[model samples]
Target chain A: MSTATATRPATPRAELAAEHGLSPSSARPPLPQYLRQVWARRHFITAFATSRTATLYSGARLGQIWQVLTPLMNAGVYYLIFGILFSSRRNIDNFTAFLVTGVFLFTFTQRSVTSGARAISGNLSLIRALHFPRAALPLAFTIVELQQMLVSLAVLGVIVLLTGEPITWAWLLVVPALILQTIFNTGLSLAIARIGARVPDVSQLLPFLTRTWLYMSGVFFSIPQRVHAGPLQDLMMANPATVYIELVRDALIDRHDAPQHAWILAVSWAVVAFCVGFWYFWGAEEKYGRG
Target chain B: MADIQHTNGQVPTVIVDDLHIVYRVYGATVGKGNAPAAFKRILKRQKSPALREVHAVRGVSFTSHRGESIGLIGRNGSGKSTLLRAIAGLLPPTRGAVFTDGQPTLLGVNAALMSDLTGERNIILGCLAMGLTPAQAKERYDDIVEFSGLGEFIDLPMRTYSSGMQQRLRFAIAAVKSHDVLLIDEALATGDADFRKRSEERIRELRDEAGTVFLVSHSLDVVTKTCTRAIWLDQGSIKMDGDAETVVNAYSSATR
Candidate 1:
């Protein structure tokens, strides 16, 4: 160590630092090492998520009940407009169950992506103060949405039963579908976190983007009847949001049929989104807190 | 540079090599602009008229050895906090680099780690965030709680605590782990005299464990009392670097 430190008068200071076995303070670790670091902080991630979810409505009078009420109200307003006003329930049995399922499922993705935008910017204090993997913040945000999704799931079950939908053995498929949706959301949250940190204006634009996605996902209407056959219908069906919604609708509503290729598309979308999002986010790991 | 050499064959733990950190703040517009103008500017890859560049730490270099506590003394906006942030890996350097043997824990006064959470939770989360396992964090829990002297207030939300209490909790959580390098930015100033003395003793114990501590404080008395060496920075460059007493005296007399 002394030899490397002493015989380098011509060397730049960076090289001298390297000779002393020092790494850049802000350098990103290798991908595998980074993933390991994230895994080790799983306890932190879960604790943070639980705490955030608990405090999300602490200021409101309704408190945690709003967790269930917020989604129920969203479904109510959409039902009044689309179900009663526009008759978006055209040719679909159990339209109440269908619409509720769509709103709840799509909301999981919607909240994940939107909150992902704020994950870094909102938690600048925590990021600057602590030395954990920056990925934990996004992961925690995703889990917060997941906790809410679970609450919404319980409400969805009651709404489905009230709409007279049967609970077949196929209802078990909701587990796999939700699991896949979560993976996809995690990846998307990670990617959006990095983007939102760099371009804060993205947060302003996210609602519009997510709204457009919600419409394209056929959240309120039955795409099979409303959309004409061709590439357009196939494209809509292949949409990850639409795919997850359809899978859940199939499992819950006895009359609703998912596309034969739904499971394949679901798995593919989850894998692709997660891998790309993780890789893209990791690319800028070291640049998170800096201006 | 001071004639006193504290290096007793210990290897250098931190090498801040000619570090330069420039902060670009948006929304400092000189002229009013509408949406279309902003869009056109973005499309053309031209910087926003609101852009303002601040060169905070300009080519500052220093090497810190193990078991040394160095106090960074400077006036407000003189880049003292920015220098510590750069050393903690929270800020990217505009030029040159900061290299460290291990991760540096930065204890800044502004962020209490988690303000909304209870002090008890913040301790656990803060410890876990710094890579301590749940078991290790739990083991350190009582020590941190006692060190903070938060008492029953520990069970209350951190936001309810005064700034001094917040700083105490932050220091206790940070000091629990024996870091390879610890960069504290004005966190100790909020503590009362008793807390300050306790923390100074803790800082000494940390140094005895072969760790390097870089403290940025406006309190010259604290600097002279706690640090073995001191560096006075002015306008982003070291004005004087020497014995803590000598540097503090020079800085005080010169400022006077």
Candidate 2:
């Protein structure tokens, strides 16, 4: 080995600082700077989300067709099980429209929350290697679901129109309902992503939790008629999922009776969930990649 | 080399003060056949799972100045990677602190590039992650492709490329923008001779531009060739810190 000495005398701390500018390292960037960083990477997030959504069904023979088919198939199954076999559609006019709407809307939230939970855990390698706003992961996952939902929603509009529901002014309300629900979904996904990073098993538990949430949201049955004056009804009414579903149902279906304050409730839930979730996720920003 | 400037009087780029890092690994087995006992304990729900804490870095302190190329040499599990991670701000210190003049970019051998996306797309993603604006990423697009020497292969998915190809691509993207602090964790170990030579030249250029480089490599030859100063870490603390030749010689003799 070449035994050349490389060590030199330490520079005076003051002179070193004066001669070459130095700032303390390892400090987390301020919130505004962090947000700017995230915004600058918007193209990356969009490209990643789009690419992931495209490759989701690469192995299947049908490929991108699965995005539209999956929700329609779920609607078909629920119509079979709950509408005809169980006769839950009795006294409900245009029950097909009602069932399809419930299934499609609920699935959007379910997929968003579940996929968001896995966003950080599944991409640990990327998280460890790259340094960007960690929020981009959960946000990207939510955007994937949003894109899928848009495709599914187009099919849903045709289904409801074909099922004899007239395109009334109320149908326009679906737009605002969708906007509110998407905000709610984004917030929930952000919260779940943070939790999932810390306790990976949360992803496993999410299916059952979302399933229970599905039933409570009245995807197949009407909650107001069956359960009257109980805490369960109150819980269902207060649920963001249920409120959003009710808003969509009231707007799209004729006979469905949504609460008078459903829109207000939906907006409140969306705003609160989004603010709280974003704060919760940002608080643990530095801890996301490290074990 | 004109690019290799002395950093004696420069401001310290990195200051690690009595840094301590502990990794909490759950359910570490003490011995064989303890599974049944552990299962029963879990079945009873007495408490949560067992916890084993690994002290990866124990009170290590070092000051590195701009324009210095420092090599960290240690065996597996010696906490070299962990310390680099802590300095990168990826891993929070269990105790003490790591202060740096600017953001430290860590380029590891296993840095995740999207396998499903084309190399071109991955390049853009990597540039964005490194804080480049979309326009800047587009501006440096051709330079990155040329540096990687992927040529037409940039249009193919990253999974189709060999490991060496992937490493070169990663190095290309990271080197596209000059960073104030660059931390390399075994990134050079996988490169070919030509790639390694170019990478070493880039490190020297970065150092001359007043960037601090912390390289962790198992190959003593690479360290001796590329780094001016070497720190030998044994267990979780610095064993020796001096001229590259002296530290490498001591470490080699002791290990042999």
Candidate 3:
């Protein structure tokens, strides 16, 4: 314990002022500086994301096996309902592969958005305790979803091969389609993260929204054959989820042909969502930790 | 009471000017007199919920210079933690301003460390969060471990450690880098006597190196012993600010 009671001799305020500059320090840092800070902590961001991914299924009895099992189980249910019961696979060749791709891709976006909404709100204590780039939380959540998707992708490839689709150079197009889908998912994650921090209850409403989107995205059945040509058809085709899912099905399965502008629409939606979502989230950076 | 200003050659590291922090607490209960009206409002499903505004810190102002250890002594809910958080830039000020010469590091107890991770991993994570590169954090790893005294237990998950051990580790990680401004909130309250002594010594060394420290503690004895100056707060306002011994004495007598 420092029990030094004697006060030190006073010094002139002018001399003190001359030695150091004084300015308000609590204001948000400039945009470039903030970007630089985020860039500098890139390693921490990746590590955090990886660690969360590693522990995500730690509590479950099956652990990481669930990652592969989840999407496969969903595909099984969809096949039983749409392929067997409804006979929706009438016109489509290799209907199993098509349904598997649709379910896997659509679920990737759904999981990313739902988990991303909880990113900031879930880590409020971490946000309050330490100073770092707030964007890292949502980015980490997206990475976790991405890691799970990689597992699902492996299973999807095996399913497509087992269904007797010949290996072709066009199969490599799945890579680009996946990359675009990931960007779109990242953007949606960031947008939902900001809203989740504010409303908190938005998370409860997300599942319904994603379910509606999943059905409209042509995951279980072919939208073009079912819906007639009109503004509604155009709107469905324009949806980025539908565009990306259709692109993947076209690339992996030989019978289906994607629209001429599918690639254009996919890339455009990815870039626009990323830019708009990032800007919206950054605008609320300083307000995230407090009410 | 007369205000005591530091006129020493040391530069002012923190200047908190007329700071006011307001908290908007939602779902406030309606009073007895308005029971029927509240029931009617609830039945109609009002768009805006009931809210009560709490003035946590009201127009408190002070200046702290380099090489000074100031203690903020207050009762529960006197806004001591809120004021420290505002200075650290974690909480935006509702009004007024806080100016500082350098970045302020707030020593938050166990809040930043992941419970499932080993103590060693948390040390690395915490260092990275404080803006240290991976290499720099690695370089300081041994020193931080030694300071924390967690030695062999560092390999175990943090959830296995006692709260006191966790707090010590947190303090060790925050103290690894000599900060220009450090805000401590009840960090010393959990540690044992030996740890407290070493923490006080470290604080003195920081002051000697021209660092500024703000300690918010309920223990007046700790304040008088470790801090050179003290500011006593009551009901979100400063009641006294002077020599640590004088303020502590006054505060103790008034409470008794």
Number of the predicted model whose DockQ against the real structure is largest: 1
Distance (Å) between predicted and true CA of A266, model 1?
Answer: 0.3
* Residue pairs in clash, model 1: none
Q: Which 10-residue window of candidate 3 chain B scores lowest in summed lDDT?
A: B1-10
Can you write out model 2's per-residue Cα lDDT over A135-188, one digit (the tens) per residue? 999999999999999999999999998998888899889999999999999899
lDDT over C-alpha atoms for residue A194 of model 2: 93
For model 1, residues B66-141, the per-residue Cα lDDT tens digits are 8889999988988999999988988877877788989999989876577777898899888888888889999999
Clashing residue pairs for model 3: A11-B7, A11-B8
Deviation of model 1 at A10, angstroms = 7.5
> What C-alpha RMSD does candidate 2 show over the true interface residues after superposing them?
8.7
Clashes of 2: 1
Query: In model 2, what are the clashing residue pairs, if there are any?
Result: A25-B100
Q: For model 1, what is the error of residue A238's alpha carbon versus the real structure, in angstroms, after optimal superposition?
A: 0.6
Candidate 1's error at B10, in angstroms? 2.2
- The TM-scores, one per candidate, come to 0.95, 0.91, 0.91
Model 2 per-residue lDDT at B194? 86
Which portions of model 1 show Cα errors greater than 4 Å?
Answer: A1-12, B1-8, B33-46
- lDDT for B80 in candidate 1 is 94
Best TM-score among the predictions, by candidate number: 1
